[model samples]
Target chain A: MQLSPSLSALVEALRCLPGIGPKSAQRIAFHLLERDRSGGTQLGQSLLNAMDKIGHCESCRTFSETPVCDICSNIKRQDTGLLCVVESPSDVLAIEQTGQYQGLYFVLMGHLSPLDGIGPNEIGMDVLERTLANGNINEVILATNPTVEGEATAHFIGEMCHQHNVTASRIAHGMPVGGELELVDGMTLMHAFSGRKAI
Target chain B: MQLSPSLSALVEALRCLPGIGPKSAQRIAFHLLERDRSGGTQLGQSLLNAMDKIGHCESCRTFSETPVCDICSNIKRQDTGLLCVVESPSDVLAIEQTGQYQGLYFVLMGHLSPLDGIGPNEIGMDVLERTLANGNINEVILATNPTVEGEATAHFIGEMCHQHNVTASRIAHGMPVGGELELVDGMTLMHAFSGRKAI
Candidate 1:
């Protein structure tokens, strides 16, 4: 069906969102037009504000509105000198939700993918090297994803840690909490066995 | 986790979309921020334009940028004098896809539901009354949904057609084209039996 020009444009633009296709876009447009014009207007304003105002934190490369993010700016976290390195801002949020760790973070924004030409410099290793050389952080926790790219990125950062005489550790790769042993993958089971400690 | 003020506001506004909860809203916000900032900006403009410009078609009560929708403005459809009455604008699109009907449409935007305080007038029956009273429309096809409310609405409009001496018919209900008889519900099986036509 031929939609009104504005409606068609709205539907097409909505497709930029992850997983929304043409039929879903049409439904969303109609729903907004019919029942939630005020909500649509509010969403539009929010989108514009966020896209225009939000930028990466200078210290961590995570999304931020200011020069440094809240975690990086906290003096108490700075004193701990425990830096958790993650691949994205969402991972920072995930780790923060645990509330068990009290440390600052350095978000790479992405992991190394050599074929994609994402070298150490591409993932902000230069900034990381600068941070390490300053000697503030005692330990760097590599909490990037467990994929091959994440591992390669972590190994590269580990070498940087050794050069600066700072300790480097990787986040564990055992079965998830509340996951059954039977359901665990072979790679994870092997990691769990190999990394076992006296408990 | 405490998000930046703008990010928090964007997540909240994204909840206005249908079926999107907090997690989905956050995912969409982060996805836009990380991967498709341009799409987000374009979507923002589209939302603002659609909300500000799109209005209900005066002739059919369907969404339209102009006073009348494209279908209603077509001279040939006006000359046909066959008006299909439906519950919403999407229904107009559904029927139009068949390419069998060369007629006009009157969208009620909703069906009769007295429990929700919806009455004939609430569903634009007054406008429908005038349309039928005017001799322009020859046939009124009731194509409201097959719910209890839809049946009541169609019955109500059918009475109005009688008052105006206009022939009124209902869209048939039976087994859907691809539906199996074994899987069809009792109500629909009854409809199929009752609505069976002799070839």
Candidate 2:
């Protein structure tokens, strides 16, 4: 049976969200109708509130309630003369999961893609350069993903950091720990061998 | 990585939606933050709007924006003196896809499960009886799936309908189309044999 207009509109609207196809959208729409008004309200209010209240931190480009993020404002964190650059806030999360680094972050929010007309200026590379010029950071870790586009973006940023006299290093790209050698690709094998450390 | 309070709350709120497992919730939550705020806002708002505005049709117990759903309201439908009863709206969708049936629907929303505290009253069987007291319907098809609980529910509802002087019939359960007889369970084979048509 066809859903009512309101329910149909709701289902269509839900289809806009990532990974929610038409069927899933209809299921969610009907489920909302069947139950969970409070949850639905919370989600709606949160979306509007987040959109209206949250903005990028001036320094880190990470989401913040204020002009500066909590991490940027914290005085306890080491001013370790080291900065790690990444493309998205999710990347910051991935790095934070390791808990191995104590350093500042710079989020690009997007990668540099020349064919798609995305450039250094579009992705806030100029702001990054200015941040580097103003800060006392002597080392920068280019922790962008090892994909072709990510690598190109990292290389461009590393060159800019070099011009500013900062020691920049690209993050390693190799087979995951515990991965079988047979499963590892050739390019990864090459990098693993070339970057191997003597015990 | 740990999300901030706002982000974490958004993700937690999303968990209330059906079919959204923890992993899918996490992915969707991050995806919303990463891309398409307009789409996310629209989705969240629609969810709230649907939950706030939509309700059950008094007649069919199906979701509707009005007192009676479109299917129940339509005068064009051959009040064919037949009622196809189902456990859920999804079942209605499945039946509607066949395009062979042109009868009215009565959604029970769930089956009778005594162990789980679900009984005829819980599934609106009492309300169904009251509705059927009008004697508008001739045949009541018990289209519940052929699970143990479904069979029990069908039997109970069938008896109730029979008492009301309405003819009731349980839907056939057998090896599905494209299904192998060898792979069919013994209970299903038994059901198939019992429900077999006389050639």
Predicted model with the maximum lDDT: 1
Model 1 C-alpha lDDT per residue in residues B1-199, reported as the tens digit of each score: 5999999999999999999999999999999999899999999999999999999888888999999889989999999999999999889989889989999999998999989998888788888888887799999999999999899899999998999999999999999999999999999999999999999
Specify the poorest-scoring 10-residue window by lDDT in model 1 chain B.
Answer: B125-134
Determine which window of 10 residues in candidate 2 chain A has minimal summed lDDT. Answer: A70-79
Task: Please provide, for model 1 over A21-90, each residue's C-alpha lDDT reduced to its tens digit, 9 standing for 90 to 100.
Answer: 9999999998999899999999999999999999998888899999888988999999999999999989
TM-score of chain B alone in model 2: 0.91
In candidate 2, how many Å is residue A53 off? 2.6
Candidate 2 ranges beyond 4 A from true positions: A35-37, B19-23
**What residue pairs clash in candidate 2, if any at all?**
none
Candidate 1 lDDT for residue A176: 92
Number of clashing pairs per prediction, in order: 0, 0
On the 0 to 100 scale, the lDDT of residue A181 in model 2 is: 94
| Candidates, DockQ | 0.88, 0.59
lDDT string for model 2 (A78-190, tens) is 36877898988878877888998778888988888999999999889878889889757789899888889899999999899989999999888777899999989999999
Task: Provide the global lDDT of candidate 1 against the true structure.
Answer: 0.93
